[model samples]
Target: MTNTALTALREPAFPDAVITEAIRWTEQNGPLDDAQALRLAASRTADAHEGITQRALLLGERIGLQPELARARQWAPWVLLGLAALIVIAGLGLAGNVVGGGERHINVIVALASLLGLHALTLLMWLLGLLLPLGSVNTASLGWIWLSLTARVAGGKRGQAPVLVRAATGLLSRAKLLPWAFGLVSHGIWSLSFTVVLAAMLFALAFRSYTLSWETTILDPEFFVRAVQALGWAPAKLGFPVPDAATVMAATPATPGAAGQRTWALWLTGCIAVYGLLPRLLLVLLSAAVLRSRRKALQPEWQEPYYRKLAARFTALAPASIVDADPGRLRGAMPASLPASQLHDTLFVIGFELPPDMPWPPAGLPAEFAAHAQRIDGSAPARRALLDQLAQARPRTVMVVCHAVSSPDRGTERFLREVLMHCGECRLWLAGAPDAGATQRWLDWLRDTGLERITASDRPDIAP
Candidate 1:
């Protein structure tokens, strides 16, 4: 079994998208055929839910559902990496345009806006998308694009690849993990872009000399001074120099002194670090933390009608092996029926379908009878195992104990008839405080099956 199958059967830690895709594949493919279904059912574990999950996974593996899902998963990270590379290139281009070109004149205000303006807008939009309850946020992300590209690259029309992609997005959206997941990728790319921008700016400043001054026709000089001081305050606190009023007033289209230019260059890089890169980096961490915390809740909807129906089918398949055709009576000669008045020396008592709360080998039974009794839950494997034991022992008399609360059915009748083939005489005992009608119902069922010699009672003693 693959890690996915193991995790799915053990807990909901299985990938939600894959779980949904696996289920979708099952839905599209229909139930497993009887032979395969019964084979899985026969090996059911103690936990019924786990048993069903195990069977579903086995069925998927047999029909090639799992391999298709695995193939799609293999291409996801590569698609994401390709998308990240594109974002990095776009970032470098934007920063190069702002700081590049061998020009003697560089506008300080224009440089800052060009570097950080779009980042601020997109960041605000991401925040708004998160606060609002809408699906729009999902599409506005690199993660969504990555998912689409992965599906397309893996052949979306082939097998269950498209279903896998849709399931992944749908589950993430419903679980509220979409925003954080998208934000994580988005902020990470933005951070990378800003890093590239800052690096380019620092490199250009170190290698090339340019005059740094603000240019405006409508805005007053005082406005520019306040703006430079205000923008520089946070960066200045962190040791980036802020140009004072004298430096700000001395501006022109011509190149400035080396000292003035140094102050302006540090100020530009500092603003980008504080306003652009730092916020995005922090958001990247925040998104990662949120996604990590909420990951467990991203499970398949087990209570959905489709899954519930599958659960019923799987449960039925679990104990279905018992319904097989009865092994013919005693190989050759039929056993002679012992009279009701006769008490055999060798007795075997079998408890079948008894309630969990019911006492085994009832309290008043003789020690000899109690010693020979064994209780079994109605599983096909258990029933077959017990039959094998009885065939070997070949006890002269066999009494099958049952809970009176359970109505007699064809399954019960077939199993009882098979038991009669192994022993000379067979008896039935419905143990519980059943009403008169319930007892009479069993009596009718017993007679109808042609096992009329076997009498049933609530009593524990075997006095016939």
Candidate 2:
């Protein structure tokens, strides 16, 4: 992964990558020790904005696992919330209004049962998932997937997509941003939806009154009286009053009075607030706390060779080599363009983690390009390791093949600079048939870097 691609996939909420933890650690601990500083020059720098007379620091470059998608995912909760709110209002309106008949009355039993029962069923599902460890019962995961899909579909076309949508698409495309971004967005959206439901219920009940009664040809009146008493026990304790047995058993048509209806309404509303909304809000809070606590030991994954090599690479740089760069300002950009085909017949072809559709090491490539062209894959450490391998190969004139349509962003630019810095006399080859805009940017970037060798070549099927 190019250092630029590292920043490409960022989701700040979750603690996913090791480099993320390292940066967090460094931010808290100040600069690296001089011994480590001498080794990792990129980590240390005088604050570019603070002025040149500042202390040098050794901060490892951390990549955002879901960089592009961060902004897009931010819009998910609000959109889903709006949809959920409309559903809730429409549902309550329907629930409160009874149709037909001379004596107008709602089956309080059905209304209460449906509202409270749905929440109860949901909680039961969650409880089952927790106790049994069944992955399929994971409501949170399902919710996250739904939220992401909703964001993508209702989010508009990719080319005209909002910046946030672009961010989400970029990060999600790589699968790097999933673990962190999905969890937070799903839980938040779910919580917001429930909150709106509760608000709608409260507002609907406050101004209006509905006669609530239960009727059953098979069940006795005493049965419902006992059921209401039992159901309202907890709710009553929590300050919402429960109707007495006479009221519970009273058929509104025969008993023609508005007795105990308000208490019943308050009890149902409170049941939702206490049992439904409260639990959800609590879960959201707990998830937030869990997200924060995970950052406690923010360190890179030692087992991954990428992080280890990256650490060593940083530590190896001299203090004087430290460049004052800003992560926020350095987003390398190039518009995605047309697809390019297999690359061969070039002096050297070094691929930097192209998407899966374009197979690596083009089939039947000419021997020279095949020999030098390296398909570098995996994490930052793995790419750096490949760079080391490329340096050893020492091919004098190498052409780095990139997904031209993917465009030459800051990450691409940085990758070229790093490859040039190490491999020498490197040129960017736009593999596939990228449009003129993307091709021109790549050429312009090469010229800006003083490679002087700027040309657009669209020889598809260089397999010969």
Candidate 3:
């Protein structure tokens, strides 16, 4: 075929080897005359081009671009963490006001802070659950807890909850979920529990009071009494039935006296517990939740299926002759009639008979066959010498067949690929399937590497 016409029929995505093989076949077998061969090659090229184009279109339709929105959903955890931080900051400001004078301001601040902090912590726990090792204390216990809560809150199907839990656990075991799952579970448990405890303690301290006693006072009784009076507590002398200093302090800690000072210490302790412990817990949870959600969303669903399909499809298309190669012996015993014409053409077929009880050698039959066939047991070194000879001789084709031999090995395949690459004019056809998938895979490998002229015979007989 004219190169221009053949080029027009080529599919852009089809590997170059397929096109090369089609062209070679058409040139050799299409017709008796040059004109007819050219015409036939053009038609075959068109058919091949159409087949590849259709396959490409089908692949595109089956697998569309992954949705961007799904990607964003996976990253939602980061946003939640930011919001949690904002809530904690506002809570701190409100806490300051409450401690200064307004009880209402302080109460509002603490409540908001606790709520935000808890959510953030939960998020962190969820993220941790996605990462880390499965069956570890953190992965097994904490991962289960957060996922269970997530399942409940999300209203995921009851059946699915168990499946998701199992998947989450597997994520840890298989190293699929990773550091994300571990983070989520760890943060969630620690933050939630801490927040609840802190809130309870703070509520108790805000509404209660305490008292103190002194061993002696050098100042006049009225001095102490006036001090208590300023704090809105009525102080009485020790000589008469007096309002207990402890009770007065409890009633009004803000009063300007020793009792009020004691109240301030208790309040300060409560504030420190809430601000320091609560915010840290919230940050952990929120970070965890965000990470877990994002990891789940970003995970590629097509990864396993795609590779599985590729392997299966390649196996299915494997040349039949190779699959049927006998395990006990090479194809039928060597044919009796050795064609001299075949040998003269630089492309030939030779067959040999072997003893039935032959014990297979460790290096394989090909090494031994080389010695018997050519009077030279061209192992690796000899094989390389043959490739060098072939590159210089530049024969059109070479076909060798050895009986009672196992399939070719990596050395044989590598030799063939090198020969094909070096001697562009020569075509090599390797027949005999010693392994189920080995030959086709090697052929594909050659094709991928641009050695398209090499072909494997699928036919049952050799009549040449």
Candidate 4:
């Protein structure tokens, strides 16, 4: 199957490519250590935002997400099939009850009511629900119920299945596809049931002898005649027989002539077909067509702030050989320092060219700094973006985290100097423990860059 269709069939919440990309992103950004993130970044698309959606399908299988999803896939179809079977059986029972199995006189009006009354009511309710917001129509549809049951059956209280299902539901709801998606299933069920009813009615009428009559104590004979004629008008236009005025006036609790009985049979079946089966069938086709046409729009919102940050991180994790320019090519006039009072009360922490081995955000840092923390590849674009943002915000404190094991370079000094100009106070964090001599060399290098106030520390507990 095509990957998009497979995702819709299996995951529902996200496409396969998106699900894998998200898993890769989580492994890298969260506490989980994933060496694959960097390796995958090397082969990623040139466009950072677009590249995040590229497939990493095996990641789920590698991380045990596939087994859980497989269980859900296995159970959903059977559950839906069982529900459909029950509906079909109910339709047969309804048809049998209406016809009285040729043992008693059939009340034509009562038969129509028994067969189509509940169907009409539910159909009207579904139509009315369409007037509300998107996704509100038929929230309790058999399809949604099947989804919930499948999630529970496969995922229970703790598994990736339910999580993925919920995500799919939320995504579909946001994309305004839930009503139509579920509507397809709901309408399909009703359509199938009505089809069964019509078939069973035709079968029973063919072999059995039953009288068709209408009896009412309070209403006049003309009322019954008008009702039968009015109800059968559309059916008659479709070539189904409708009784003449004399036939209607003569209907009693006794079997009529063979021709008259044939007319009644055609009228009853035609009315059911026109009113009950046809509407549900048309709705099924409409919902299916809508879902087919709009399926392409069923993608994750990559523009959201959370995904944006992940995109930036994906770019940052790219290898230096791919993104960085030669040190001699770096160009920009030194910026003037902003006043301390202009800075906001924000703690901005950035990892500057830290090696892949170092755990990001420096484990001991306070939780409040989470939002402001970022890691960059020290590429020109990354520098410009960071500088532009800092220029506007001018955070109160800026902390540049570096790998203590690596020696400082002129490019590092130049970037630090430019960054220092935008913040009120700056601190240097050497993320790993190196020898005292190496630490001294970094500290001395900071002084030579005309940054004496910036002290290098190995710990993350330093006050902002």
lDDT of each: 0.68, 0.49, 0.36, 0.69
Candidate rank order under TM-score: 4, 1, 2, 3
Candidate 1 TM-score, true structure as reference? 0.62
What's the true lDDT of residue 371 in model 2? 58
Give model 2's clash tally.
38
TM-score of model 2 (CA atoms): 0.46
Give the Cα error of residue 53 in candidate 1, in Å: 3.5
Supply the global lDDT for candidate 3. Answer: 0.36
lDDT of 3 by residue, 63-127 (tens): 32112112222333443344335444555444434444433212322443443455455555544
Clashing pairs in 1: none
For each candidate, give its TM-score against the true structure.
0.62, 0.46, 0.30, 0.63
Q: Score candidate 4 by lDDT.
A: 0.69
Model 3 bad stretches (over 4 Å) = 1-134, 139-142, 148-163, 172-179, 182-200, 211-279, 282-286, 289-310, 314-364, 367-464
> How much does candidate 4 score in TM-score?
0.63
lDDT of 2 by residue, 96-159 (tens): 4432223446576776666656556755665565456454555345344554455465544552
| Ten contiguous residues with the weakest lDDT in model 1 | 1-10
Q: Residues 372-440, candidate 1, lDDT per residue (tens digit)?
A: 899888676677667666555556788888888887775676567557645667778777745888888
Candidate closest to the true structure, highest TM-score: 4
- Residue ranges of candidate 2 with Cα displaced over 4 Å: 1-67, 77-103, 127-135, 139-147, 150-209, 251-258, 297-300, 305-464
Segments in model 4 whose C-alpha atoms lie over 4 Å from true places: 1-59, 129-131, 134-136, 252-259, 320-464
| CA RMSD per model (angstroms) | 15.6, 18.4, 21.6, 10.9
